[model samples]
Target: MKKLKMWLPFVTLLFMLAGTLTLQAQRKQGVTLEGYVYEMDEDQKFPVPYASVSIASLSIAVTTDENGHYVINNLPARNLQVTARFLGLEEQTQEVDLSKQQVLDFVLLVSNFRLEEIVVTAESNKAGAATASKINKTAMEHMQLTSLADVMSLLPGAATVKSDLTSVTTASIRGGSSLGTAILMDGAPISNNANMQIMSSAIGGSTPSTSGTTPSIGVDLRTITTDNIESIEVIRGVPSVEYGDITAGAIIVNSKTGRQPLTIKFNTNPNLYQGTATHGVNLGKNAGSLNYSGDYSYSVSDPREGYDYYRRVTARIGYSNTIGKWYTNTSVSFLSALDKAEPNPDDEQDVTIKRQNDLGIRANTKGTFTFNRNFFKSLEYNVQFAYTDRDSYFYDEATNATVAYSLSKQDGAVLSSIQGNKIYDVNGNLVTNVPAGEESFIAWTLPSQYQYDYTVDGRELNTFAKVKANFAGDLGATHHRMVIGADFKSDGNVGEGKIFDPLNPPYRSVSYSDATQRERSYKDIPFVNQFGLYAEENFDWEFANRHLQISAGIRYDHVLNFGGGLSPRVNASIDILPEALTLNAAF
Candidate 1:
């Protein structure tokens, strides 16, 4: 009763606010804008589907349909700046008087330039929007990146770190822990939530030296290749309500799509060698485009010793098409990464071999439907599924001078010799009999040398689905673009957890006197499910030759077997000198 009462006021306020906006939208006068976008080649013009047409000043945008047609209704009656953009094409902008005209058409030209002449830099987002940096293909090529982690150096206030594939690296945004940052590729979020690769609890404080796998933190950047990436956007400020379960920020990676020429590349450095190939094919007049890419890289920690090394291979297949009023893009990707440390024969005391392997496959589809309705502009949906298999192995030569520990999990179990087949409790009652290749407990004398090894197998599966509707309208002098959406996510692991010989287990930790190590399967763990709903209102108002743009939204998340909460956010900006300067704030 108390909790419901506490939330009543907030609920009432939300309903009232929505009602007021609806009423104002119904009373205002609005204009409808429609247009077609095209590409020209040698006196010939062809419709360009999925081209973006937007009003920069008003923050209203729409995508061209299969026939290269777009319709945006309820726009304010005034002069507006409109822009058109498409992949691999030059952008076009024009000034138009919406009060006098209703139809606009644009013919975009193919982008022509040599790669060597292009400047490499991270471009910042425009004023009156969330703070972000974008890195395009030109910049990525100039840097000669070997992995996705190399892009971090392009961000502001970030220092370059030498690339080393032998170590695991996770992304950290704005001084926050890596776990708080969300990484997404092609509108689908990558998840490491189901990773539980940990040393057996019975081993206690004996930590193993492992690399290339991040269990509790986040996705390992070393596993992601940059050869097929088209652009990357790092959002450092508050993101939209559509993004959830994040505290630091989000990293959005867009892969290459559409028609393209076949290209192959090979790069070699002192410690790294990489090869890549990418191509795109037009399936026919209206069949769509097929794109594919492959990458392989090998790196050594030290050229002299070559004891520690890393190897990665990646492949991707993508398809983009427009069927009627819907535009869809689908892709499937595969990755395999291995990190290993070989034991050097010269060092007799350092006989150890450690290896970590990561294998994964992902499939995703994103679609958008443009509607010609008065208020409802478009609907978008995304579905993604991913599975990963991880294997970690450690081997070492163990030597103990004078210690013998019990292997029994019970706190007060008796320690018996290996010759004994039966075990008895303190009260002289029979407890249990030892099985083959096993002992009741540790009863060795002193000075024992043995070989120890352990292996962990982890299998993770993640699925995500989202559907959202976009609305555009006008309320008096304010132009509005709103989004309402819901999403579902599920993460789980099913694998044969830790596997090792019970007779020759790793050395137990001295710090924990009563600790015991035992094998455990991960298949018994429960799946984590999360459902989220969000709504956002973006509006721009003009008065006295000044423009004000504000974006406000709220999100609700419910986790199965756990509680839920609400998060509200707002970002506002006011022009101080038109495009020259602006003031922005968020909460």
Candidate 2:
């Protein structure tokens, strides 16, 4: 009985080895998969290049070539789920046995419904994904949005506020400052860093109420029209390293594209009237498409107060084309805004008239190049340039009873009376007045009820450029998509700032207690330059009947005067019940 027991143990080990060998032989019997992906048009088939073909179970994916031909090697000879997808088209999935049929072709159809037509409300991402919300054109139309600011109410935890264009409006996310949120239009930044519209505060020249411009805070949402927007995506969670110069969150705006019929809309409210026209034209065969849009709006604080009004006009032209393996889109836009507030006819004493004008032009080009290679997937680039000219004027009647003002750009107290009065220094020494347009360290008290006007002219320019490369491949059982990119930006202003008569400078207390305002030219300030480098990796792994997705990235930024800063981020999610439940975490 002892000898039989030893033989039985050896025999069991031999059987186990044979079973393992048989499993290895079955795995080696893989088949090659080759197919063509195309679209049908009136019973005719045309190749759909750059379409994605993937096997989710095995984490294998590939893109079709220019001829819509795709090939996958060493695929398991068993039943598998294959998916094919492309932009602006319906996705198709099928289950088939590779051993029986190696060549699997797909015919994709154009989606009949627009994304906005189906989504009537704000749509959120799945639980396991990043915290994001998307608002489409249909939602904006339904809400009768007059400006981009009105769209903010659609977000969670936000209350609807009546749309008003008479005042400057900015966006704030997560209770953070407006500067912390980054606003992007078509992947290009809408920067307000070089806005120097405020008058020299030393002379009691604060921001004018009718300026309608936000300086040092962020973009003024009221200036951005919503008629030409296609979609808006707000990211409240930790965003990808591709976005920088932000701490709270990001708002991405995508403009309309492709071929569409002409659309004209007119809207009227109690305080606002807006009109917009948009059209898209297809240039036939391989020529691509051209799009044009224009919007005009006028608003007043009250129907009876015609003296205070706001006017805005915007126009845009865009071109989209695909040449060879590269696809490019270029656009140019123009904007003009005017805000004016005049004195009422009944008020004889108050002659204050405030007017602000803003003119801007922006141009941008973005392109993508696809490559059918083992390691490299695609390359993307974007370049943008923007220029804005702002003019602010404030006119008021000053009635000083016994106030002494200074015209001296230097420090120390110098006092003078009306035009005929003598000037004196703080030490009670006699000071001679210089001729007009000459240097004089003296102060003068102006006549009562005189005209006090000052103008601030500021010209700002901004430029941005970025280049990124994407790579996709399989390493062992994991599929990875890696992205590496670098971006640079520059902002500067060159304009005559705070223009005023030296003889009758804005009234300010001549006492030592009050801070003095000095004349400063916008061109004197230095330009700001920023550079950033980023890298990110997104991977998917399937194990033990569960799927895991993780994204990890890091970024480095260097400012012209400031030192470099580094930021690291990670986000992970795991499916617990296939499509039913998932756990997500981010840092």
> Candidate 2 on 1-587: residue-level lDDT in tens?
45445445433543453344334434444478989999876789998765668764443566676688888765556667798876445568889887699999999876553344334233223222457878767677667788889888788888887767887788888788889899999888999998888745564533343376757688988888987787788888777888889988888898776555687898888889999998887676567678888999999999899899999999988987777667788999999999999899788975889898999999999987765344555688999999999998888765552345566554444445444366667999778555444343555544654666788888999999999876555455665566679999999899888887765555554353344457789999999999998777676788888888887777778897876777777778898998789888988
lDDT tens readout by residue for model 1, 65-179: 7788888777666777788877666668887788899899999887654455534343223322567777777677767787878887778887876666767788998899889
> Which pairs clash (backbone N, Cα, C closer than 3 Å) in model 2?
202-517, 203-517
Q: Which regions of candidate 1 are displaced past 4 Å?
A: 1-83, 90-97, 100-128, 161-163, 399-402, 419-449, 576-581
The TM-score obtained by model 1 is 0.87
> What is the RMSD, in Å, between candidate 2 and the native fold over all Cα?
10.8
Clashing pairs in 1: 202-516, 202-517
**Candidate 2: segments with Cα more than 4 A from true spot:** 1-129, 199-210, 399-401, 412-441, 446-450, 507-515, 576-581
Q: Which candidate tops TM-score? A: 1
lDDT of model 1 at position 562: 92
